[model samples]
Target: MRQTNEEKINRLEELKETYDRFKEKPFQLNLKRGVPGKDQLALSEPMLNILTPEDLYQETEADFRNYGVLTGIPEAKQFFSEVLEITADEVIVGGNSSLQLMYTVLASKMFLGQSDKNSAWAKEKVVKFLCPSPGYDRHFNATEKLGFELIPIEMTSTGPDMDQVEILVANDASIKGIWCIPTYSNPTGVTYSNEVVDRLAKMKTLAQDFVIMWDNAYVVHHLKEKKEHVQNVLETSKSYGTEKRVWMFCSTSKITFPGAGVAALGACKENIDWVTEVLSDQTIGFDKVNQKRHVKFLKDKKHLLQHMEKHAELLKPKFDSISNLFGNYFGEESTMLEWTEPNGGYFVHLTTMDGCADRIVELLADIGVSLTEANASYPYGVNPRNNSIRLAPTSISVEEIEAAVKAICLCVEMVSLEKELDSNK
Candidate 1:
């Protein structure tokens, strides 16, 4: 039976007692970022000693210990090519951070321009990039730092609302690009469907040199038996003569050591040549030693998938715990509270009742549980509804996950009840 106003008030009092009990417990848990735990990091420990002196001087004999191989060694390029399913010529094996590579791509276009015509976006009157909400904060921060006005687009289950994307881009010449996490999007774990990919490929834009920053960070990070395969954006755009519009990025940061893993960017021939030419002045090359290390450790796509399965084995239980706890606490009887059960990504996005997210976060913090800041997923650090909270269950242990999630559920229910009772008054 649905609870009456009086019943809700009584429930709030009971929840407050539990909340006070939580405050008395001595524990500090941080779930602010999606990071691989110690166990996950331990899985890649063997890679540190996988190489030797002779291994460094491979078939190319390019001298891994020396400077040069500006765009990356041929073998490194080939490895990432198979990973991204793009041609070897289309890949540029970069340094440790894919985020850095992404920033470089945007900064390159902002200053030097995207083509031979030298149409620098920095010279333009106003430039904007479409950002899908409940998306990655770093993506928003990157473009915002580059002076591109960040526009929030509604993120649907399939992907960003393409109709809205199409309408906005078709009318605004100043809208230069959009940030996309195509497969297993950050926080939401939304993989773009074929229709969404097709619409994005064929969409008309006022800006002739518009681009798509495809950050496929979680491409192979699957948590279930069934893997999702998004349509080939590069091929789809090629049919529309929009091949130059796609700039795809990926990295083995999560698979191996985050601070030392290899990253790469995939693009059309023109983009490859353009970025290569631009990068020439910037550096001699990325860390070839680390590149060779990852190449030998991960080996091929099959082995890479095998490696990720290990990650899933460790992560699946934590995610399952979160799901089961949510069902137990916030069951069908709950109102105006929901969350995404992501398949592959590192976050579970929670939506609390309106005006309740901030309070829920505050309440959890009081009990020594730290979460990602409320509204950290949106552009400018603001969710208009103020109802979104991102939960990262990757870094902590399974026991900590259960404790944290239970505390979260209690706080969520308490906050919701408090809101309901206040409104009734």
Candidate 2:
């Protein structure tokens, strides 16, 4: 399989011709988003019909219309508590979109500070966060918008490099928090192990009120027959008297309608009370009717699993298609590219040859194929290595995934070859 100088040149020419032929087609293929496809969205149609004339009131006897339940309805608290495996008293259901909730949490800290320590982030000389790289960009952006310095830690197999994390937090009080997508992490899809969780819960930070933004956005979003387990960070926090240290966030955005789904936060009593107080000033209540629809459809943990299983069935094939392309189209084993074929979550983490991601994305875009912009997974939208790409396989059809992967592989090879040629010269 070794190619000589002449052969590599010929292969490059052949790829250019093939790419040109694809460009001649009149269709545009977009794989840029991680949104649920129409078919996936349709799965929630049953929820729309789950509510009827017989039930306008919750079991707690709270009316769905009038503003009464400040945090959430009793049943919603019960339902989310079961799903998150936390006590009902610890869960606070909020409006749709966990991203919005996450931003709200940060905003509250920046504006009002936590109840116990009222050092507003804006007043701090230098507020910083330990960001695990190859992470969710939105999380980084939230901190960035408020002007908190983001210092990235290397992502290891088990989790963020603990040695680096422990050292940094121990030395600097300015490092107030870390952003983690613990279960089935956003782009890379590696769940944090129990040992990592234990260390985080016990880690020493100079800041008395250090926070851990544990965005468990994909806790139940499984994509394999054998589901993965992410150790409960919040629960572990209790043992260290750090129960108020972590803020856990999740939503039914993927489970039901992303546009109208409900979100929840799992925390200790202190954190829960603080957020409730701040949120009360903002609004009387979140949408109870929407919460009712979700509770009616997903009655308990078992029903939630059953519903997620359907999403897995619809998504697995698309994931397999990307795997096949990695082995078949790119190579059975490629040196030019590397990726994480996650067992769960919505993305496949792709890393190209050094200094090649931006070029590959640009090359693909010229041919009417769209992907997430390069460096999107990192803080500041700048992948220092310029080699990482997040591939969202669950939103498109099998055919679209195939086409998109082919084009992606083509651009990958194209950029890699160009690099090799330049080095030789």
Candidate 3:
């Protein structure tokens, strides 16, 4: 329903009062990140206590107390292999986080390059990476900090605009990488189509070492009865002799504990060997004792999948609550606002009318409603249209999410109508 200027004026005043009242409540509501809830973390308590003092070493005769394995324990590698659909030999398990693994891989390329035969990336005159906008900020930050100029690419429902991606990569030899969250992508929650992945695998690049950061962090994080799966990226790339071109990663951070979960990287044997050789010089090995803890508890994919079902129960409600609210408040009535209905990811991507998200975010922030900074999902923290806001419903309580998103609806309407009023003049 298009509102008359008079009705909008009255609604604006009412929303301002609502914002003021929320500001006075003196309570903090944080939905700015996709961190798992406390209830989700508690499900992994068995992992911590699973290992008894009696079980100090793994069956491979490797003592967990004294680290010797550099490429992670065999059981953990096999476990990750099962989860990622790559071979155990191709998986390299690491400590607690995938972001760190991703950074280290990028850093290694800068100084060490991909292999002994290749030149260091830092020596390149102009290094660049194609970044799909509305992507993972932490992924962009990893390359940005390393001096690789990030060129933003458009994100469509199927995937990053593959046509643009193809043209840019084909023309720019220096464009060595592109960031992708193929399955249930970060904020938008759309999976890459088979065609997109096929092109990504088959498309040729001048930079022989061109890589794709395939972060399938939410691989098992499904929210519905039926689960969606992406084509086996490693296998697809391998078929095209480009398996080495993709660096696939996932972690139990959200599954178990963010700070103590196990992370893994999967690639062809050549890349895995290169990383292990470099890592051997860096340290004895990662905390195998921690690896043992996880392996002993999760044991296999069945247990892990069952564990995730519990998490889906906790998260589904939060996502549904906010989505329903969006439909109710910012529906067909408004040409100025739209949001994503993600099937199984941690975020809801909301887009207000052009030039309105930042103001809506600021207005909501004034009332103790903290969201992921507007456009934070984009490269360099700039969302050019100034209208995308990532709403994370997982971290906050159901009650808090209800209140926080209602306030967001208020801010979106207020900003959108204010813009409409000015445009009318």
Please tell me which predicted candidate would have the highest lDDT against the true structure. 1
Give lDDT tens digits, candidate 3, residues 1-425.
56798998898899788778888883488888889988888888877778886577647577878868889989899999999998899999999989988988888988897666357899889999999988999988889999999999999999999999999888889999999999889989989999999999999888888999999999999998878889888899888998878999999898889999899999999999888887887889898888889988888999889988999999999988987888897676668788887878798998888898889888888888888888889999987689899988897789998888888888888788799889988
Q: What are the lDDT figures for the candidates, one per model?
A: 0.90, 0.87, 0.88
Model 3 stretches with alpha carbons more than 4 Å out: 58-60
What is candidate 3's TM-score against the reference?
A: 0.97
Clashes of 1: 0
Per-residue CA lDDT of model 1 for 10-90, tens digit only, reads: 888998998898899845999999899999999999999999998788675788889999888788899889888999999
Model 2: lDDT of residue 350:
91
Clashes of each: 0, 0, 1
Model 2 agreement with the true structure over 277-305: per-residue lDDT tens digits: 98899889899888888998999989999
Worst 10 residues of 3 by lDDT: 53-62
Error of 1 at 382 (Å): 1.6
Worst lDDT 10-window in candidate 2:
53-62
